[model samples]
Target: MKIISAGLPRSGSTLVMQMLKILYSDFPLQKVHGYIEPKEGQIRICTYRHPFAAAVSNARIYNDLSDEHLKNSAIYIRKMAKAVDLYTEDGVTLMLRYEDFYLNRKLIVSSLVERYGTKFSDMLVEKALEYSSIERNLERQRVYSDFAHWDSETHIHGGHISEYKGDPTSWRNYVSSSQIQILVSILNPVRLRWGY
Candidate 1:
């Protein structure tokens, strides 16, 4: 089976990938570039909301497909779906909101199993509990880092979602209001749904 473990960098995707790897113990996974290049038969990362990547695509698509553009007043959820489809066409996709897993992990694992079937295993679930047990996820707050170089604003942090109490806002101290808005606009929906 093919597994892609990336989805826009700051979306708590790496933690999910690690948890999956630790849990399944059989995941031959690969991290693909976000829109840099496409490689077949490998799990790819395509964060739907990262500003830099999104900006690049918006520019490219607008430049190329601008002729067929839809009106600005439209909600355009289909466009989002098409983007997801373009990047996430085959195999199993594991794009867990860091906040969701942080707030409630058991539900997340079970839901993933229900949606994706047996791709998620008991051992992986067990290990997630082991790695993220409340205290461990707290340590991750300090494990995160970031940079603002205009082309991209990347924040890298580590922790198991099972450990989080769903308060991803704690990371707010590390970024700016602008950053928070950007992340919230993209993640708040899933985060709230996931209970983080």
Candidate 2:
């Protein structure tokens, strides 16, 4: 089946693309940032991260992240969430959580294959998990300095998903308490809905 992967920044969109590349070596998977019009029978797998963490990553990457920036980010995130939810309700897309994929790669693959009829194998899934491991991807960056520029022209620190000090809440270190409160206030609905 045809597939397109889209997500907000730092939501493991590249990782999802890498996993799909390994899991369905023959299938063409498009890695994109925003929505693309899928052809018939095409399935879009949209990835999402906790909004607070995403906002923190944005701040780290872009470095501006003023109050206005966060407000705009919240607006954009709400629009993205609405689109993902609407598409999912219509069966045109599947929403995958970055945290879930990182913690339960096999289960995510199995569910996709079973529920969405995507052709995939357990062995391939295992291999993809290993191939997409943080260490391997980081090594890739080391060997090919160009790999540092994946989704953006500027260098992004902490490109590795596992670089968060072994804690999901490590974003707290980057953002201030007031910023966190603002992010939480803006994204509370989505946080509650997504159980983050």
Top model number, lDDT: 2
Off by over 4 Å in 2: 63-72, 142-148, 151-162, 165-167
Model 2 residue 185 CA deviation (Å) reads 3.7
User: How many angstroms is residue 49 displaced in model 2 relative to the true structure, after the best TM-score fit?
Assistant: 2.2
| TM per candidate | 0.46, 0.77
Which clashing pairs does model 2 show? none
Score residue 152 of candidate 1 by CA lDDT: 14
CA shift at 151, candidate 1, in angstroms?
Answer: 26
Clashes of 2: 0
Task: Give per-residue CA lDDT, model 1, range 123-187, as digits (tens).
Answer: 66787766645555445444543121111111223322222233454333334456445445554
Model 1: residues with Cα > 4 Å off, grouped in runs: 32-95, 119-124, 132-134, 137-166, 171-196
